[model samples]
Target: MFDLICLGHAALDRVYSIAAFPPEPTKLRATQAMEVGGGMAATAAVAAARLGGRVAFWGRVGDDAAGAAVRDGLVAEGIDVRGLRTCQGAVTSTSAVIVDAAGERMIVTHLGEGLDDDPAGLPWPMLAQARAVLVDVRWPAGSLALLRAARAAGVPGVLDVEMMAGAALAELLDATDHAVFSRPGLAEFAPGLPEPDGLAKARAAGAAVPGVTQGEHGYLWLDPAGRARRQPAFAVRAVDTTGAGDAFHGAYALGVARGLEVADCARQGAGAAALKCTRPGTRAGLPDGAALSAFLAERAAAV
Candidate 1:
């Protein structure tokens, strides 16, 4: 049985390191470059696997080299990829990520075309073996379908609210037990509202836990008791921040599977996110179980 199942987007990322984003649309020199697997749920699956959770990735990819890279990358990270479907003739999603000296990154993505969006053929029975399910906004149909099924199966569903239309957000929120929004996603959900107020809106819509990931600043959430809580980000010299949020969500889902309290789970997430920032690239920066444990232990000792 898998400890967590990640369902949604997956892609290959071509990353470049540069001193800064060019102010003008002009030629610039890259300090470094590499290719790696990315996408929200896909990276999260890698994070959970690195943290020693039995994780599985469920999503669709094209039958192409990019798709193969996505599959092989996850497999190398010890994630189960049996559910990663290959759609014939479709092009797998891909992204160009450029990271600057401060570790901030700008990404341009091509979602690709001719891909199947239907979740009907997905293995619904697998919910029985999963302790928790994580979904992203990239695939509304698949995310909603899996979220509903996970809810019915009594498996926790964590929504990576990266970005979505208002209607889709509302529908997914109702079925989501834990709705963790990206900074932009929270603003889109509750425009002009404060973080606490925005998350409150998510709570009103039936999400038991509504949170946002604040890079460097850390995580903020409304707990089950209606109390607003915070998990300050661990101090790290960031080399890249590309997949930090994904790492947080993955670790948080694993914590939920382990029956941790919401606050503790956020700490787990924060630790993972901090560690992820210490290196370049997406999956390359993820910390393993031992690393995460040691990081958390040191933090505890300092406290």
Candidate 2:
């Protein structure tokens, strides 16, 4: 049985680092450039696999060089790609990531049409073997369908609710056991509500756990008892924040699968994300089992 199954988008990313945003109609040369495996669910899968969890990734990719790169990257990371399919005529999904020196990024994505196609034909039996399922908002139909199946199979379903329309957001949350939102997603979902209040409101809507990630400030969560807790972010020299959240989600899923308390799970996630930010690229900087254990051990010793 797999520790986690990630069902959503996967793509190849070309990241360019510049000093600042370019001026109107002006072009700026990048200070550095790199290519890596990216996409919300895909990155999280890499994170889990690197952290010692048995992981499976279910997504579609075009039968192109880019798609092959993505597949090869995931397999190299030790993620099971047996559930992944190759679309014959479709173009592979791709992303152009522009990162400023401030560790901020702006992504221009081309989610090829093939990625949105229904994933009903995927290996449901394999998916059912997962301890938990992590999904992203990028593939709404497939994500929801997988969540429903997971629910029926009594597996925990986690929804990484990034910025999406209200209707879609509501539907996604309705199917999610745990709803983890980005800062922008929380603002969009609960217009004027503050973090704690918004989290409470989100829980009232049927989510077992509702949380929002506030970059360096850390994360805030509301438990089943209506109690709220905040975990402080670990101090680190953040070189790139691209896949920080994805790392957090993957670690959090592993924690939950191990039956850790919600608060402890969030702390573990924060630690993983902080470690991820200390380097560059999405998967490039991820910590392995011994590294993560040492990091957490050092934190405990300091405490």
Candidate 3:
């Protein structure tokens, strides 16, 4: 049985490392560049697989060279891609990421028609074997469908609330057991609430639990009992922060599948993200089972 099933878009990411944001109308040479598989759900699947979870990914790609590259990357990471679909007239989703020396990034994405395809075509029986299902906002309709099915199957459903519109945001949260919001995304959902207060508001809106991830500042989570807690970010020199959040989600899902407490899950996620930032690229820097175990052990001793 799979520990987790991740459903959303899969993309080929072209990352450019620069010292700073380019001046308006001015061109700056990239200090470094790399291409790899990326997308909230896709990257999370790879992270889970790397951490020794039995994972599967359901997403849509195009019939193009980029699509092949993405599919190959996931398979190499040990993520089952039997459920991945290929779209006919569309190009695979793509992203151009610009990272500053400080490890901060600005990304421009083209989601393409990846979001329009139905995820119900996925192997339902196989998906049902998963302990939990994770989805991103990139594919609204498919993600909603998967969440409903997971709920009916009594499996946990997690929503990675990335960039989304208002109504879509509400609908996504309503279908999720846990809602983890990006900072800007949470502000747009609850304009007046302060950062910590926003987590409470999101939880009250229907999510069993709500959390906001503040990079480097740590994460603030409101548990199912209405108690809120903040976990400080682990100290590390971030070389590239591109996949940190994805690593967090994957490790958090692993914790959930293993029946770890919510607070413990958040801590594990934080630890994984911190380790991811110590290296370069998204998939390249992800920790394997042994590495994560050692890191977590050291973290426990430090605490």
Candidate 4:
């Protein structure tokens, strides 16, 4: 049985590093360029695998070279791709990621149209074997299927709430056991509501545990006692901030599978995210279990 199953969004990313963002309309040069594996759930799968979970990725990719790379990259990270499918005559999802000197990035993507949106034929039996199911908003159909299955089987359903329409977010939140949002997502979901109030809103909407990740500011969530809790982000020299949130979600899923308290899970998540920022590529800085523990230990001591 797998520790976790991630069931949405996988892509090949072409990354370019430039000195600054918003370059002139004229031609310019990138300081560095590289190709890497990306997409929300895919990167999270890599993070979970790196953190010692027996993780699996169940996503659709186009039958192309980019698809091959995405599969190979996950295998290199020790992730199980048995459930991943290659769609015939479809282009794999691909992204152009541009990083500036601040380690911040902007991505432009063509979400290839070849992926099948219907998740009714997915391997429900295999999902039943996993301890937890973590999903992204990219594939609403697949996410709903997996989330429902996990809920029915008493497995945790961790939702990565990024940019999505209100209707979609509400539907997913209702089925979500642990709803984690990005800062922008929270703002969009509960516009004008204060952070704590917004988290409360999500919880009231049926999410058992609601939280938000605020980049370097830290992570904020409402505890079971309905109290607001915050975990400060770890300080590090960030080389790229591309996949930090994905890393956080992956670590948090593993933490849940490992039976950690919510607070401890957030800490583990923040640690993984901070470490992810220290490297250039999206997956390059994902920490293993030992490294994560050591980093948490040192930070705890310093605090």
Q: How many backbone clashes does candidate 1 have?
A: 0
Local distance difference test, per candidate? 0.92, 0.86, 0.85, 0.91
- After superposition, the stretches of candidate 3 with alpha carbons farther than 4 Å from their true spots are 114-116
| Models ranked on lDDT | 1, 4, 2, 3
Q: Whose TM-score is higher: candidate 2's or candidate 4's?
A: 4
Off by over 4 Å in 1: none
How much is 262 displaced in model 4, in angstroms? 0.6
Error of 4 at 184 (Å): 1.0
The pairs that clash in candidate 3 are none
Provide the global lDDT of candidate 4 against the true structure: 0.91
**Which candidate should be chosen as best, given lDDT against the real structure?**
1
The alpha-carbon lDDT assigned to residue 274 of candidate 3 equals 92
Worst 10 residues of 1 by lDDT: 162-171
Tens-digit per-residue lDDT, 102-166, candidate 4: 89999998888778778776777887678888999888888888898899889999999987644
Winner of 3 and 4 under TM-score: 4
Candidate 4 C-alpha error for residue 125, in Å: 1.3
State how far residue 106 of model 2 sits from its true place (Å).
1.8
Residue 297, model 4: Cα distance from true site in angstroms: 0.7
Order by TM-score, highest first: 1, 4, 3, 2
Q: How do the residues 70-99 of candidate 1 rate in per-residue lDDT, one tens digit apiece?
A: 999998888888788899999999999999
